[model samples]
Target: MRKKLASLMAVAAASTLALTACGSDSGAAAGPENGDKKELTVGVFAGWDEGLAVSHLWERILAKKGYDVTLTSADVAPVFSGISTGDFDMAMDVWLPETHATQAEKYGDKIVELGTWTENAKLTVAVNKDADIESLDELAGKADMFGNRIVGIDPGAGLTKAMNDRVIPQYGLEKMDFVTSSTPAMLTELKKATGAGDDILVTLWRPHWAYDAFDIKDLKDPKGTLGDAEHISTYGSLTFKEDFPTLAGWMKDFKIDDEHLFSLENAMFNGADTQEYAPIVDQWISENQEWVDSLTAAKK
Candidate 1:
């Protein structure tokens, strides 16, 4: 089953890339006749649901305004590289001051940050709600309770790097086994463990649907080893602002608080398939029409 699922995901990724290439070619042909540049390619991080939701939201919203928007999924490294090279016009979910510091530093001059839209973004080691432990400090002594393992997502992820470099050593958890896998795999394990009322510790982040879908709580990071809360920002190619000032301005003023983001993520990813999020986001926009209008209201 896992192999079949992996194959399906791989096919879907290939399809997305094809669509991106086609969209770019078609949009380029149409731009001159349209009297304005109305095409945008957004680079999205694979396995990141927040990026998926926001990318689809923008794709649908911009399409309404006659913009041809394509979402291309890639790993973090390539996404930043694409953005820097101007192959992608924007990236909507960049965790700042820590998670993406390396990428930002490397490509800082090549890209422009439009603005931060979500605050208090966090990375955490979370456990089932009924777990005995409330903090990271308590985990070392009770390692066996969680099978002496910390389930983690992509090894290339900044979260994974932080866990191995700081969280493990700082909390004396080096002895515990840290399992690395894809985000979907980790989530599958989380669901199985939680459904059976078993203790499970998994790397998680805020602004994610898992928090809304599961009964879990973050283990307190008293030592600050996991780092402080960060901000989620929108980044664009260097020419993005010049090419689409109005859209850039709209993105600059776009902000969603935790409540709205959680609800949006829940609506899109909690029970429904991620690929079907565009319609869900369209419905969400209707429900929050005023807020949607506010997001695109012309700057005075």
Candidate 2:
């Protein structure tokens, strides 16, 4: 009986030590001592359609469970790097089979490639309707009518690289330059041209407010440089799940559909305040609890 009691005590001691090892000062000081105070960081990009996405999905979810989180925007170049290193605990904007494939390759061992947060995301080449350009190939050499420019997002964005190296060449525009601007800058340029009834060609994506707000058409690409439609997803450091299994599992399971993404993107595209975004999205989650739970319920 004494030997068995001693074994039980030893097992208890080991479990306590394991908990201490998993948590830092902040993670240890609060309620549960295992992960009660464990804080997570959710990385975003200006590319994230809704400003509150990280807050709604990461921060609020953690808060609901009595933990804390910090939300920050990941740099276009360093996003993959950050998640690879656990600098940011989780990131949910990897638009893939296209957007982050290179980054995934670049950091294969360092990060965990979670499945899509939402599927059916798209990246498209758009032309103003009035410009009358029916195909991506036609834009070549029409500097005046097509503006001889492909308005792109950040230079570090993988889509920009793909377009500059592949799309431009496939379309045979060897001399034309792709303007590596941002989403806002490209939108401004497009809107300016629209106001003047001028020509503008741009790199466009779905789950964006632009589709709802502007009259633009996606040009056909015979070469398929943009690839087929893909999903925007979540990724994390190699240790993300090991660090927070429950939250990581939730991330793995949680998903948004086209309608959900479109509504949020449309709201932000119309200029919603950033700080108020979390509550708005949380409300959405509450309203769609059944559907959301269908996706987020613990898997067998």
Candidate 3:
């Protein structure tokens, strides 16, 4: 697992190399030295669409406010570490009490909580809506129905850890194989399975574009193994508030429900070919002018 995580980090390093022209290479805090917080850096979890969406949205929002925001992409753990060491000023998505619990434990004290923007987050195991099973308890008996396999995301993902340590064993799925790879690979398989009208079991999460893009439903976790819904939050470095007081207040009051978040995700992800999300976010902002403006509105 550590090797796999190291491999992912290697990929991130390569990506960081490519992104040098766009942002700081060392992930350093960059700006004018006179306590001017016009420059900001946000660390984004690679492949996490919700984080990517909100981060880009803020990059657009802050840019309009005359702030130069740099969005840096990395793995989950690195993002948290960057936040702690002040390399990244903020990160938009941190799942609490479960999925990112490990990161929160290690870096919680070193960062500032910027408030939760949404509470519709959760780790889930989903199958096509028409699948015969409705609950995870029924999966073992019907494992063959899903080709006796459970597709999963990154090997080092907390969801995969939960599955390996709790869900599979607690549910008596020792005989079946749980595949772990990248999120895109898992999503590609999901797309293939759904397109072919085949029953497929895959690890997924809520507040994700997949829910809107795929015709699937989360299987019931009657034993509470997968955990209840969690909040999606933003966190910042220790000096974030001191450096960016105005932006800090806006972040404290930030709120976006699942419906609006999903729309932005769909616009940026669902059937979109390019990775450049600024224009898409700009379009979304144009359409949701009232709400977008409210995000940065003058405090009463």
Q: lDDT of each structure?
A: 0.77, 0.62, 0.80
Superposition-based RMSD of candidate 1 using all C-alpha atoms, in angstroms: 5.4
In angstroms, what RMSD does candidate 2 have relative to the true structure?
13.1
Please give, for residues 149-183, the per-residue lDDT of candidate 2 as tens digits.
77876665556766876888888877776887566
TM-score-best of 2 and 3: 3
TM-score of 2: 0.66
Clashing pairs in 2: none
- Model 1 misses residue 69 by how many Å? 1.2
Candidate order, TM-score descending: 3, 1, 2
What clash pairs does model 1 have? none
Clashing pairs in 3: none
lDDT of 3 by residue, 38-108 (tens): 67888877767788788888887766655667788787788899999999999988877666778888887
**Where in model 1 is the C-alpha error above 4 Å?**
1-36, 271-276, 298-300
- The residue-level lDDT of candidate 1 at 32 comes to 31
* Candidate 3, residue 279: lDDT: 83
Give the clash total for candidate 2.
Answer: 0
lDDT of 3 at 178: 96
